[model samples]
Target: MEIFMKVFTKKLFAGAALSIAAMSSAPSFAGENPTSPIMGIPASSLEEFGGREGVRAWVESLFYYIMLDNRIAPIFREFGNPERQIFLNTQLETMVLGGPNEYQGASMSAAHADLGITMTQFNAVVEAAYNACERNVIKYHTCNQLINALAPFTADIVTR
Candidate 1:
């Protein structure tokens, strides 16, 4: 009787272990694709970043800081046409929000080539941009991801 009980217990434990393993390895119903460009984050997730309103607010704040609080403001004030600024802002907002718009701004390097932007100023702008995103309650990782995506443009925008 003892031998029979021992075998039964072992089989029960093995079955339970297999069940747990299967559960762990099972596909989730959430339809997540871990390798996607959006990191499996759904568009609905934008709600957490304040949706369209949040995106607009963030872009406005970023422009305000860059155009007012930073030395770059003077450069823009000297050469930036108001209409161009408005168009750029719109394009930036659309791009940032994953909307259907393409940013056709001058390549970053060419844009800044004549201005002689320093590393310090570039860093400051980057910091200000992130701060603007945070002020609008954008998710940290999402904001970071967006920043990372846009970062390659620095090569085009930043220069000696």
Candidate 2:
């Protein structure tokens, strides 16, 4: 399982990196403003995951993987409550999928400021998210796109 996770993580990161690069130079779709992609994700991508309920299920799967990961589980145990899970679902829906933008949590930096998170721990969490995406049967490119959307928050999240 460990070896499999290593390989999967490598592929996921590579795919996400390439997707980000390509998107950076990609042209706008017909009748779509150049910046609209930034403002909101195409509804088609959401549909690929079976819509909003699927996103919530993905979040549930993410936490399941996170808690199973010995490397990061302890660090995240504090956030295992039902309320926190709901907040995470909404936050991810807003942040990665361009949903309603109803996230009311603190900034990522502020949220992790005192946690002293290391780069390795952060990457493990990202891996878990990718795993969740796969487990939810989201398309490869859509998963990559979601990861790309989240890439910018690394600086704010990896405090150590």
Measured by TM-score, the strongest candidate is 2
Candidate 1: give the clashing pairs: 108-156, 108-157, 109-156, 109-157
Tens-place lDDT per residue, model 2, 24-100, is: 44333341232223322565666676656787888788888988999888877864464586666645453345344
Q: How many residue-pair clashes does candidate 1 contain?
A: 4
Predicted structure 2, TM vs. truth: 0.70
Model 2 lDDT, residue 83, Cα: 55
Q: TM-score of every model?
A: 0.60, 0.70
Number of the top lDDT candidate: 2
lDDT of each: 0.53, 0.63
lDDT, candidate 2, residue 98?
39
